[model samples]
Target: MGPAGEVLWDVALPASPSRLPGATMAGFADRGRTPAGLRLIPPPAVTLALVFGPGTVVLSGAAGRGSVVAGLGFGTTRVRQAADFSCVQVRLPPAVAGAVLGVRPAELGGAFVALDDLWGRDAARLAERLSETSSWDERFALTDAVLARRAEAGPAADPEVAWAWRRLVRTRGLVRVERLASEVGWSRKRLWSRFQAQIGLPPKRAARLVRFDHAVHRLVAGQEAAFVAADAGYADQSHLHRDVRAFTGITPATVAGEPFLTVDDVAWPSSR
Candidate 1:
């Protein structure tokens, strides 16, 4: 949920009775004359979205329905929403995504796949079941069950790879990839390849994505670009500018005004 002039939108957590590990949930709806299109800036986690309603929800250039899984830093995306619609969006940790999705997150990077393709008829069943639900709480419970089942049955990430990923996230991506390899007792090449296979991106790019995510939020909070650059660990404002452009293709000021980033602000202003 984000940017444009005077467009209205809303964000909410799922109704109570929720339980999922390493997954953050948010529900979205249109209020008033929402914009025809919404941009999705890259984020640091994999995304799962369930969309239903009279209006169409387009992702990137493709119109989508049912459920979809998108990889982290999936580049610039646009969602066209209907006048009346409801979406339950979830962000999953990369390792959790690997287990639940049954594929390397790298396979989904820079792209999205319909859950139907991956889950087959089970995906269709999920869509139909969710559409029939009488309450949001029921819908969330069903979703949690499906993901929990997969996470339990699927293979886990290598412990070293998982630990290295945790370090990158904990450090806000400020940790050096070289140091990660050394600390994990693996050669740089081994770490890089394994990290990419398991996490959907090379260690360095994932770190950049995480760092950019933190820095961008500060920008949205009204901090100066220069200040965000320094505090967020960029070498300089120019470095920050380059990273911003690489991810969003817009300057810092333009990215800051984005309504997508502001939706969470409207729902949880304290998050900033």
Candidate 2:
């Protein structure tokens, strides 16, 4: 799933039978001997990474290392491992971040925090349990059960904000924020404030992030930049390039070759 001469990391998407609301997907990646580091570009959903690894998960410029809860990255986030690693990564829409993690999306805003900070003893217990598991399937089941239990103990998002977030996702980030406010029967100001508080990004920025995500997948699919720009509602190729570079710190051509984006079709099939 990588370019020529690139080490192919093994990635598996394990199905979550629980159908937990607001949870997008969960995956297992065991990058054995792949020296390549990872840059997690801006995506529409928050990310939770739990490591039961052969190596430590280190974030750029951070003093400590551990499993993390990352908000919708407003910009590029770098992750590196010194050696082979095994971990379960979960994608949670903003609506579920609070319920499943007991924190608002805004709390994680634009940064990655050690899961131990948020989950305390529970985080350590889960890591120990996951490390003891013999297979990925067993780890996934345990992880899903933990999320379900936490969700029940935490607060859910405001119904209106939740609805608006779903609409943005369903539309692939192409819908207008004003229109969304109207549809939700909230004034534009109210919608803007609440969305920022709960979802961690303003409605317009969220839309742009989601749109950028869509364009990234298209580029990875081998679509021409001009066509992807036009189809994704960008003003032109330059605008699309600007957004891609802003989110990923690289040009469209480079992003197209990124193993992370290229492998997403298999790792996140339905999302692609």
Q: Which candidate number has the best lDDT?
A: 2
Judged by whole-model lDDT over C-alpha atoms, candidate 2 comes out at: 0.81
Say which candidate scores most in TM-score.
2
| Model 1 C-alpha lDDT per residue in residues 80-194, reported as the tens digit of each score | 6556667677778887788888877888856777877677888767767777887777777888888888888776888899889889988999999899999999999999999
| TM-score, one value per model | 0.90, 0.94
The alpha-carbon deviation from the true structure for residue 56 of candidate 2, after best TM-score superposition, in angstroms, is: 1.5
lDDT of 2 at 179: 96
In model 2, the runs with Cα more than 4 Å from the true position are 5-7, 16-18
Global CA lDDT of candidate 1, please? 0.78
Clashing pairs in 1: 1-260, 2-259, 2-260, 3-259, 3-260, 55-82, 106-200
Clashes of each: 7, 0
| Model 2 residue 37 lDDT score | 64
Prediction 1 TM-score vs. true: 0.90
